[model samples]
Target: MTQTKRRWRVSPATIAPVLIISWAVTSAIATGFNFRPLVLLELQTQALFFRLRGEVAPPPELVILAIDDDSLTRGRDAKELKELASIRSWPWRRTAYAEAIDKIMAAGARSVAVDVLWDLPSERPADDQRLQQTLKRYAGRVTLAAIHATSESIGGGLDQLVYPDPMFQVDPKAIGLINYSPEPDGQLRRFASVYLNQIDADLRQSKSDLLSFDEASLQTSKLPFNAPKGDYIFFYGGSNTFAIVPFWTVLYPQNWERLKQEQIFKDKIVLIGPTAAFLQDIHPTPFGDLSGIEVHANAIATLLEDRAIAEVMPDPAWRGFYLFLALAGIGLAIGQVSKRTTPRFVLAIVIAGGWWLVGYASFVYGGLILPVAAPFLAISLSGLFYLSTGAANDQLEKLRLRRTLERYVAKPIVKEILSQPEDFQALLQGRKLNAAVLFCDIRGFTTLSYKLPPETLVSLLNTYLNAMVEAVAAASGTIDKFIGDAVMAEFGSPVSYGEETDAMNAIRAALGMRQALAALRSQWQQEGKTLLYHGIGISYGEVIAGNIGSLRRLEYTVIGDTVNVASRVEGLTKSFWTDILITDALYQRVQEHVEVVFVGEHLLRGREDSPSRLYSLIGLKGEAPTLYHQVHEELRRYLGYIEATES
Candidate 1:
């Protein structure tokens, strides 16, 4: 059996459109407008891409002076600190940070951002005065830290700003909202350049009156903030990526010479904050968990260069467009693929990989955040759905073909044609091929029909036809059609097993039909019912085989001289007094397999000039001496006499 050719069928245009819209809608719902789980995932993916691409060098102009473990431990361990420190705790006094600020500014730093908050006054008035005087000395060049108003501060009346005490008199320009709000997953992925205007409202001043230290420094540097308001993803490298200095190094007089020699803080933006592990200001970020001061430094670095990750899709509409394109392109490609597993599977993988590449390229080269996971999911799911439906349609088509073919052929033959339908379709369309055509007819059917009642006659005819069909099927013969009580069958046409096998199968089927009729006759005689008998004639030659009749109803059968000769020979069986007859062509092919008697040459209906020799079939070589034993024996003697005379 030849393999069936695969036919690729695309689903209707509406299928892709509907599925695209559904995917887009689903994506929109899952990643809510500001509730950004998908956005968070995209940000994480971008971080991975950047990490694999390698770290970008940070700006040298930004410096972090962390009051780290050494500063805290040394300050606490010092004998003089143990006596002089009234609190004897980590946060010594405002005076210590005040001295550090003076030293850093004296080192020629461009600006000083104090990440520590002074929301309350110091216990000693002298310490507060010292910090106050230091801020007054730098004024516009120094910025102080302010805690962003949290949910608990809702009753603070709109300003949503926490500032130092009035006695300290810190410059408002020095106050930066140190709120590095993280995503809901507790990851610090973005930086808020400006908090809500509620702070302006609470201050009893216009919105213009309130500005975070970040905004003030950008203004001081004469640089514009290019990112949108609210929040933007700030690029962060690993922890401790920035140049850091211990707070005590700048404050303690002993280390002054080394700091001056290094000049690391020369003309740099200095951020002062705590970096001790005991100070739980750490937050999770993409690179890793970092101290709050490092988060601020990363924000400052991003602001200095204006290198915030630009969102390729700032609106839901843009994301919808991406989803549409993904589904349309991949869905159409999947639709065109044949209903074969390997091709569809390969196509699915390619679509997924292509979408991922597009997203990654957009982010790496353009600094754009493109949604990858959702679009990839949409494309893969659409392809899988199409492949599943295509498979179902293929199975349905095979079943339909099976139902049609089984009516005219055996179950196994039907199965073969369905499995490999390529040649079977060609056979249905007209083709000329060599085949053995067997025609069987009941003897005296007209008289037999009248003698019995209508019901009895129909029942008897149906029983006879059923037996004939079974015999033909048992030999793998294709039933051409039934005419009244006559059955026509063909072999080696629609499906071939070689000419010799077809000839032998046809002869065997004819013999089975004769034996079945004989058995029925015996049973009917014992039960006192009408007897039945059938005559068969087979011919082998080229004939036109295909569907015949009107468009609405067709009969699959063979035509041409071969079929005509078979029918004519079946008609002569009564005259010759034989149960089965075959033309010389069929007899020659099966001569080696069975015994036969020559019945002399006779002119068939259409071929009157070229008379074809006919023969009566005897049982298999030594099987039995049945109804044709006398004829078989006489033919052997006659052939021997003729040979002797010729010799």
Candidate 2:
């Protein structure tokens, strides 16, 4: 039993599409993992977008009364304040905050939310009583911090609130929880309106009606905030985005009248909190570190204005759109390879850049955050995949075309064409090129074939054709075709090496064929086989050369008067009784490099008025005639001569 061989076919153009599809599938799967690399990249893009846009305007009604370094130092140096000042230390006397609250309320502040905690009783009973009196006097207008369980633990348990202070228990409605939950990366991107169960219990236990201070401010303003599931991704500006005034400036007697004149606290939600560096109330935001007080102001402003940051829809359909974009980019690049390749690459880059810009613009102008990294990575990888594989395909095509051409033309000519594909394409477009045509035919082949068996005659013919074909190839000549017992070839075409070189190559090929045939005849005679002879003709002139035929079947060849004349000249070689002959055109072109004797100007069958001058080729200018030429000259007068003549 015999097994049949199977052939596998591969197309060079198929590689680009395969790579594109693979990249799209792989990237889509990676994106589904919420891949950590793209997540980090998204964070960077978010930060950069905020930094480039700088600060956005905050709500005008929101202001922070900062308990800053000046308020803590009271215009004294750290050493002096520590050693000499009675009320200059941090966590200043509760009476000081009570006086500050009294001043802000008198100045017509809409609401006062103290970021400071009042979860513990003061060491001075008089100070606690004084702060409690102010809280009771403006119970509904003021709000104080209600420390939650977690925040209480963070503050060293000094202000941990099992309940509100006993002094303000009469006016517990003035308290709200001051707890913030930052993101996992320690950047504050959003805020919560209400606390969890633990803080909710603390609020109820302290008897505070508001969930948080920001919620209290929102409730007091009677503005509606439509957040999704009670969660808000609020817009953030840089540090100190809100109008902040030092706490001491409002509390000092001389500055109290100045604040009233400036209307700084009039109808504004004044949030009083520590802004000093030593207080460590700063939290990292996308723009920079911001004080917890300003974060609250931002939260209140977001609630009052109802401007929350929207997110890109996290749906499979949305993710698939980005994957489709990557596939489209690769398809576009591959499609353009047959035409304008440079514009294709430029457009790929522009599309990738535009994709990122769209994400950033959505965040900046539309208050929405769109997914950026996964899509960008997919597009970039697709582009690289197409470009790299596309290059490999081009190289494979060059190699394939070269192999096919080597069968019709010489190896050297194919190499030259492969090196410059552009020039080869131009030549195939049908152009007039200077070339030399040579025609060789076996002598008396019709009668000789009848004397031998069909198989023997065919084998002899194939041997002769092989010898002639090799001779043409060795001389850098293109084998145009084989007609019966004849061979037609061309030199200096598809590519030109000038008329002079073409003439020399054709002449050299004819001489080589003469020697090769002589060797074949000797071998055949030694083997007791009938010997064969052939005649050659060469002509040099302009010819129309290119791929000519119907679109479905084309052939690269030449057709002109020069081709006809070369065939007619080969007939004359038999008439002159010589193995080699050349027209006057080819002879004159190569006269400087080759030695030839004039055969005569003869009027052959077709045209009598136009007669062609022909010559017989000898050896090169400096070569000696060997046994073949010597025997040929003696055997026939057309073979060799010492001098050249004009007919």
Candidate 3:
């Protein structure tokens, strides 16, 4: 195919590598960029395989309403709040808390837990009166926030949050504490399981000894925790308990809540925190940013239902390892497919896919926090490298072969030689080769050519010469060259191995040539075309053969006196009045292996210094066979006769 044709479509030569390259590049990207995207993918993967083999947290049951722009409308008019001097500076409107608390009292929810700070006493007398009235109406029904204790002893709890009102009219029996002293990390790593500290303080102040006095009322606290190991108790309800309802919802009558008689303030755990804008009581965590109330909810839900991400909190060393593995694994996977463009890209595919599979399996199933980066990139890049490199090398080999062979051989022959690279270089070698060398010349070319038109002579010569050269190569002989109508060939040089049967091969080849020309010669006679004629001499001898001439202009040929005599013998073919003739030396070489019929002895036409025996090669006998079996048998009889005569 031509280059233009190949350009228009994907060929076998190009399609394969292209596919492999695409795979590798994609694999490289997947493996290279390891960050939030990869983690999201991992989470999705976890969702696929994360089975609740142990206990599962109850599903989140609460809905959310962000204390967002919508909540501003319920509190106070933005314009009015800005105009009011004292409130413009204070974050919340004086009456806002009362309005929200009143809404909660009307909602009829099981319990209302206020995630607010009431550490300082009420400021506005009117606002305080309104709040106190609401508090009395919902007495013992609402759980209020305590100002967290910011004890310079580094202690901070519900005390610092909400200060106790002197007119605290809510029923003491219904009151509950909403306080959490959590970690700086914003994770509620530990907490007191029960309100024992409060029980202690409440007793110190009231001397009621509530822990013992509350035996009948103990069911109301309903602390579900059971461990006795530390002053702090760990209570994790199922994931269901961890639901984070929006703080803004507490102001909506439909979405708010009031304590039911059965709540732990009735029969449930109540958590509280600030979600109001000015409060900004939130921090970041692995689960994303969350409110302290939500964190408390998460802690309770964790203890109740025990759901968690299985973290293999690494030793310092493994932390580095985990990071490296994750990034490296992804880079390698993408690199693998990017490197190859072949249909057989299974290696890269299998390997990269395996890395991902392995990472997923270890993290999800095996519960091992492994490094996912390096292995993934290794497989991907390696595949890409292997394929791209392979294609480049293959193209190079073809070009080299094409350039090297074109210098000496014909295109078709060069193609044949290249078709078998294994044997091409070995085609030329120096060896003692016994071959039937054919040298043919026009019988009277000089006179005949003068008689015909130049064009006519040339055409005739081409016809005859073309016919001879075809015959030589067709018979497994190498065409050395064509000298006008005189053609030279070697049957066992550049190609040998049948030299033992050289004499027979030469005879059959010569006969084939003579027979092949009968029709052509007859047709030429009928057309008033000149009859073609030539002399062919075959000889067998050890000859030196290989390519000869300067490096720039070399020819494949055989040379020696054996070749000279072959030419000299051709000069005698016409003199002997035969179309074919060979030296006695060729016949002798095949002495016991073939049969030859003598055509009689003759003096060479060009150099008649000595006469030589000439013969025609006949076929061999299959049984009791030896080369020239008949001649050797006759010679044996003659040798006995000579022995008797000598005696």
Candidate 4:
């Protein structure tokens, strides 16, 4: 009976649920456990988005009056300007701020916010009076900086609220806290319009609010503030994003004329603070380290322009968005109708790229923030799962094939076939190649069956065929088929070790079968059971070898003249009164390794015209003499007697 080949295929429907479940479980774990890595990855991706957006133009209404390094150096070095000489070094007199504010207000500025904190009265009483009077003059127009300090006592909290001195407190609403909230990574990305002093029982209980400096500045300017309660600031750019006019320049007569001519401060909210590195007010941002004044200006600009970035994922309604994204990406990667890995990988990459594009576009155009790292990780994990499953399935299929192939061929041949699976698959379709075919048949099976009962006859046949198969397998020969008491095998068809080697292996297998049968006969004789003898024929030639028959029922065997000749030679063994026979073609290949005697040339059973040369295989050249050597002597004497009789 012909055997059919089975194929294994992976269904996408079966894999889809696994991928979905894996994604859901992973997302749940990440969300429930609050995976910090994913959060940090999200922040980094957001920073990347900022970098990709590059520098944006800040609002023209906002300007920074910076106390930079240049102004500080000139204040001490420019001895010609005796009025500015007193402004040298750290903590310049409050009189300079008083004068700068006067000049800025005189220039038709909308508002002036001093980022410096004058928490203590100046040593010069007259200078404090002068700064205090100036602040009161522009009472509601000026916003002074304050701080929320954490108490060193147990349970550190915002227990201390440092405000400008009482003398400088012109408008109560003009004092706002300058405290910035940095994320876990020490990067400043968020701003709050108003902070509730939760640490102070009275303030928390009374529901009084503490405003940020940016909020106070906007309120003092009388500009519309439309920012959310707390949101991520849409930074205009990195450092120097806003226009900067040095403090000394604003206060000097020569520079004041230049500034007034250009209308630098006109209708603009001027933020006065230290921009020099020595002042130590720098903080890390998405773009880079920026001075505190620039951060405040960016925050104020965000509120004034209503460009706060709102996170959509934090909303409960949108929580499923990540799951959907992960599924879509995984599906694009592995849920394909075709099971090719390259296309799936390419599709996965496209999905990731497209997601990044959408995220960036949404951030740039819609002022919204979408998740980046978590979804990407989900997609990557899903792809890895798919690939690992595919690899495992492939291994299982190979094992199945190997087991199936081993049924027909020996373990060594099966290993060869599996090592180059594609090539072996092609060979199974059919190929014409040189190989050695062997056929072995019990000599007197028919007579033995007549003398014995049906059960004994079947048992004896099975025992004989098993020994023959073991011999073939030991020599790396493929067992083609078993026809009753006869066995057909081939060497070097599916996998070859060269023509000479195939011929030698076939010879070796035939000799091994002879020895196995000899032992069986001796055992049967001692047990007083029927003894059996067999003849083997080996032929080497080109033959068509492959799986033949209908698709549903196939047989992997060799066909053509080489197989036919081998069968004919096995039949000729009875005529010669010998056990083993080989064709001239096979003898030629294995002549050096095997000893053989020429048999008379004769036509095969099918062909009557052309006669073929045949030989009786004796023993291997290097091995000790065996039963075949005795058989060789008997065969020679018989041939001589037959020749004499015929003559």
Query: Each candidate: what lDDT?
Result: 0.73, 0.73, 0.52, 0.80
Model 2's alpha-carbon lDDT is 0.73
Put down candidate 3 lDDT per residue, 1-647, tens digits, no spaces: 65643336443434434544454444335434544455454444433333322223443422222344345444444344322222223455435556655544444333344555554556567777776777677665445544334435545343332335656535653333444444334333333233435434643355232221111112223434333222221222322235444434554334444322222122333343455545676644334455555545554443443333343433424544444444344334444444333522457657667867876676544545444443455455545554565455445544554564344223555556556634233445455667778887766676677788999999988888767755664565666777767877766655454666545556556655665565567788799997766678888887787657875566667888678888888876654445567778777766675555687777765447877788654444443333234333433454445355556
Listed in order, each prediction's TM-score against the native is 0.73, 0.69, 0.37, 0.66
Candidate 2: residue 212 Cα off by (Å): 6.5
The residue-level lDDT of candidate 3 at 195 comes to: 42
Could you report the Cα RMSD, in angstroms, for every candidate shown? 8.4, 7.7, 17.5, 8.8
Residues 241-342, model 1: lDDT tens digits: 888888777766668669988897888888888888888888877777788888877777777777666666667666666656656666666756744534
In candidate 2, stretches whose alpha carbon ends up further than 4 angstroms from where it belongs are: 1-13, 57-60, 73-92, 117-184, 193-237, 255-261, 299-307, 320-345, 398-415, 421-476, 479-488, 497-532, 535-647
Highest lDDT, which number?
4
* Candidate 1 lDDT for residue 509: 90
List the candidate 3 regions with Cα displacement exceeding 4 Å.
1-68, 77-304, 311-313, 319-345, 357-368, 393-647
lDDT of 3 at 426: 43
Judged by whole-model lDDT over C-alpha atoms, candidate 1 comes out at: 0.73
Query: Candidate 1: where are CA atoms >4 Å away?
Result: 1-25, 28-56, 81-88, 106-108, 136-139, 151-159, 164-174, 194-205, 209-231, 252-260, 321-325, 386-451, 477-504, 525-528, 531-647
How many collisions per candidate? 6, 0, 98, 0
Rank the models by TM-score, top first.
Answer: 1, 2, 4, 3
- Model 3 lDDT on a 0 to 1 scale: 0.52
* Model 1 residue pairs with clashes: 143-174, 144-174, 158-198, 159-199, 159-202, 176-213
